[model samples]
Target: MDAILNLRENAARQGEKTLTRPTREEAEAAVRTLLLWAGENPDREGLLDTPKRVAKSYGELFSGYNESPEEVLGTTFEEVSGYNDPVLVKDIPFFSHCEHHMVPIIGKAHIAYLPDDRVVGLSKIGRLVDVFGRRLQTQESITAQIADAMDTILHPRGVAVMIEAEHLCMSMRGVKKQGSTTITTTFRGTYRDDANAQARFMTMIRLG
Candidate 1:
């Protein structure tokens, strides 16, 4: 049991270390290289400052890569007016980049959690989504990360997250499915074990 606990602690430490931001210069150089790889001259008049601009833009877009979702969810409110119901925050807008193609994945996320003894501010849910979404990631990882963050911080009875996104890599380049959207979901604890609870959460999001 001690060994298991130690291992878990080590893993958590490693996860914390992974949350770091890149230096501005590094981001700029990467953007420059990307432009060159795309057969564009980074030195061209119109493209001269493009690398810096892209780097700055990436600092905002991928800022989540440096942020800890657990940290973002640290503060909780105990006063809930005796409301012991599932807290649902839906249709939170998000933008992410596909790690594979580096193209945009634009979407909305629906999140719900059943509190155990504590509940987070409603805006925190949206902020949590942004913290994970503003990075180069897969939809699967993004969905799972949000669910895991809520589960860990809130220690809730259950957590559920669903993301619906359209990938520009597919729609703008390969196969070009313009109107197609991909849906990904992750559920923890009761959200996974109870069908009715999951169905109700999904229904609420769909209706809205």
Candidate 2:
């Protein structure tokens, strides 16, 4: 509970931090040290700018940490036209970091909700995934966070989230299987109790 609260607070603190651009010189120095330790010459022209480029790329790849899922889901539309069935957005691609290894996890997320009275914009679901996915996460927590966010924001009859990912830590080392994937899911409210509804959701997402 305390951890959840801290996440909420941290989300609120997004955009307050001073944007510090990492120095190319520092990155080059670090790379030099790495290359030296690995018995290579860092001064080689081919690898000279690799460190700076990598540092810049890191800034872009990890920028999601400075954003918030709650704020992304803040916009709500009560004008759902009373046509509430299941609003599902599937195959939402997300790139996240694994907290355990600090390596990348790339995945597709499926989100579905049965609205109560209010509904959110379609894009908000994607944004929510981005918010949660950008942080250091385990697949289990990522699944639960999406469900919880939808339950909180939409007060939906049910909310379901499914994630399928391939972790680099698993693929790049330690019994490496190149084609392996992991699936994690979370279901809330009616989706949790009603097998038929869950089945429908799974079928829908599984469809190509």
Which candidate leads the pack in lDDT?
1
Which parts of model 2 have CA positions greater than 4 angstroms off? 1-39
Model 1 scores what on Cα lDDT? 0.85
TM-score, every prediction = 0.85, 0.80
* Highest-scoring model, TM-score: 1
- Candidate 1 residues 112-204, lDDT tens each? 999887888888899998888887789999999899889877899999999999999999998999989999998999999999999999998
Q: What TM-score would you give candidate 2 relative to the actual structure?
A: 0.80
* Candidate 1 runs further than 4 Å off: 1-23
lDDT for each residue of candidate 2 in 1-208, tens digit (9 for 90 to 100):
3334554566667944433444667766777787789998767898877778776776567656666667888878788678778889999999898989888999999999998878889998998888788778899988998899899877899998999999998999887878799999989999999999999999999888
Report the error of model 1 at residue 11, Å: 12
Residue pair clashes in candidate 2: none
What range of 10 consecutive residues in model 1 has the weakest lDDT sum?
1-10
